[model samples]
Target: MGTLSGNLQRPVIAASAVCIASISSDFRDKFWPNKSSDTCSSLEQANSFSLPNSLNEPKSSWVSKISVSKLSNLSFVTRIRIPVPDINNLIPVSRSSSVSSFLYSSLTSSHALINAYQSAELVKAAKPASYTYDVSSTPSEVLYRWHLPDPKSIDVTGSSDCSSVKSRTVVVLLGWLGAKQKHLNRYAEWYTSRGYHAITFTFPMSKILSYQVGGKAEQDIQLLVNHLADWLEEDGKNLVFHTFSNTGWLTYGVILEKLQRSDSSLMGRIRGCIVDSAPVAAPDPQVWASGFSAAFLKKNSVATKGVTSEQSATIKEGNKTTVEAKPELTETALLVILKKFFEVVLNIPTVNRRLSDVLGLLTSQQPSCPQLYIYSSADRVIPAGSVESFIDGQRRNGREVRACNFISTPHVDHFRNDPKLYSSQLTQFLDYCVLTCCTSS
Candidate 1:
């Protein structure tokens, strides 16, 4: 990934803007709104428990050339605990042990959910693979086409070098809904133009249940991650993640299983991940299994017509035509089968976001990769209180996060709201996670 913001707000032709007022009114209106009516009014800076300010930005650290004499106590291992939201369950996720050992032990005392993907077909199915992309493709390939403003619709500019940067040339973009963009062709052109090799990988979206037979999303994740893990192995280059919402659950959790193999050096190259509004937890899976309203099941009964087909049989739960094929179908009934297909298949939850999240903490088989968690008190989806609880939990556990940016934005689209700040914050976080880690090594 490159340092370029890939934001289509100002003309890519223009430079960056230094002064906040110089930024277009549209920019401020979108992200940095006057917080007169904020829900989390207490979001003002509370360093009572915050990461170092220097750590917030990219600080270059070089690989120490220390002699063996300085290697004191190599046997020492550290622990970090990540906070998992519990509905009064109070599950604790620690940072010690391998980071991949993250698991959540419930009062119920079992995690059969993780076993769903542990099958031979699932593992074989998870082998790294690649997808053919049409460079000429436009909105057809973009996941947020409808959400993105006409290129530059969300971005505004002055005359700064938003395109120029001197840090490492890796750019990890967390995509919305697990879709990948030929960012190199569009926003990444600035980095490519400057001779930077920009890499963009698709992230898989995880849901409450695995989508088999009819679940293409999880399959997409397995293949896409397989390809990325292999590529990272071939060329020992570090990269960052630009994750979107719960997709981070699918993106990192699925790879953690494969990365733990002794042969996967690619897993070690993950310098850091950049997440905004990451959903490491999920609602009860039973909610999805038996929670479907009769209306949703009946209206969306257009699952693959072949319940007996092997390819479509995985998701066939007892041939319950409606719910088995497409459980928790949220769309209104008037949509076409194709629209319904897109709604159902494309929205499949190959992995349970909530389950993997708790497991991410408990199953720390590897070192907890450094992360920059950014979210706003303005985030309506995950309450501001969640952020507060998260901060408190992280601090109490002695696991230090590089930084947490408390931006004054509305919701999950932190970057779109305040491109300049969001871009700057993200760039800094990437630098710290990657360049710093590289330097430290």
Candidate 2:
């Protein structure tokens, strides 16, 4: 029985020696291609002739004391055998040698090889693919839509020179709270029709309610800022910001802050700013409540409805009869509750700090570009008093300012209430900006 066992072991040892030699050769080729294949062949020859002194030592002593550099000088340790089941025949057992373990520990201890592998992985992970916003595709998770003008259908409203100027302009439309891509698309199309690239940005209500100082919303805004910076790198292209409500105004402030920090030169590319129904300097709880209520209730909100009066009058024009009554925002039970809720929420240390930081940037860090404020006295969400005060402050700071108060329109409803007047204001401002930009260049 002992002789039979010895004969079986001899054959197994011989096969193991051959397998170890092949594995060592493969490992050398993979990690150290410069190393000669003769090293592994010598290991196999030494294993067949005489085993190393380390094989006679205890497993713990050799494993603990072995160094990677010493591996090339030593032969295989043949005494250790780990039994592994053969996949083809379950009843039979195969022996795996200690050479694999030695090779693995040696590779792991090699700092240069490990660091090179890690660096390659990091580079592979760090590089982002180039992304261009395609208007034809569905909007991405960023919750913004980009529209490029069509060359064939460009509306040359005036001279050929004006058309050429408009072709190089971009209109950035920042939407109000709870506004969607669909809602902003109307405004976007208005610009696209005039041969201007349009980018409409809106924040989701979920992101607003769960707002954090440097959270997902800020990350998304950073992406837009980066894109804008890249866009400005092209020659002859400029931007016009058309902001709606306090939400849009605050977003614009954030964009301005980012641009100022990254590349202040890009801020010079902004030719004009069209502020619509916005710019409440500080964080007012009531204004926030009103804006949020209008967002939640939409058309049904008291903010959207006009006060009724017994004195109804109609004016007769050449072909149109105009109603004189104007919509007014009134306080309601829901509004009272929302106001109180926001009073507490807005005062939270983090929330207050974040809002104050943005407000500070808006007040002190505006670009030296032409600004147009189109607002309404009857806006329920943003108080006319606040808008006028902010406008006065900007004018006092020596900024080129223009303002038009749509006396009867609701918040951000100037365009929908009277398209002709709104369109006229936009057209004049865009033309002036383009002409000014061209003249300056």
For TM-score, the strongest prediction is 2
Poorest stretch of ten by lDDT in candidate 1: 107-116
Candidate 1 structure quality by residue, lDDT tens digits, 1-441: 011112322533242343223443343243333536341113111101211223223231111122211121111101211121111222232344421122212211111111111111111222201111112111113222101111221112322222112122344454534235642234343333332234444432222123343245445555445434433432434455555554444455555564554345565676665556654344423212221222134323332112233423432233323323342344323233434433443334442343445345523443355666676543333444454555455545654454454434433455555567765775576556544533454
Off by over 4 Å in 2: 1-142, 152-159, 306-331, 437-441
Runs in model 1 lying further than 4 Å from the true structure: 1-134, 138-170, 178-210, 213-215, 261-264, 280-367, 391-399, 405-407, 437-441
Model 2: how far residue 100 lies from native, Å: 36
Backbone clash pairs in model 1 (N, Cα, C under 3 Å; residues 3+ apart or in different chains), count: 43
* lDDT score for candidate 2 against the true structure: 0.64
Query: What C-alpha root-mean-square deviation, in Å, does candidate 1 show against the real structure?
Result: 24.9
Q: Residues 1-441, candidate 2, lDDT per residue (tens digit)?
A: 223234456655676588667765554333333334332223222222211334334463233344433221111111222121111111111233554454334323332121222212211222211111232111122356656564444533334555556666778999999898878888987887776778888887756765667877898788678656655655766889999999999999889989998998998999999999998999888999889888988987767754222211111112112433322444476688888978877887777888889899888778888899998665667877788899999989998889987766778888988899999998888767766544455
Instruction: List the pairs of residues colliding in candidate 2.
Output: none
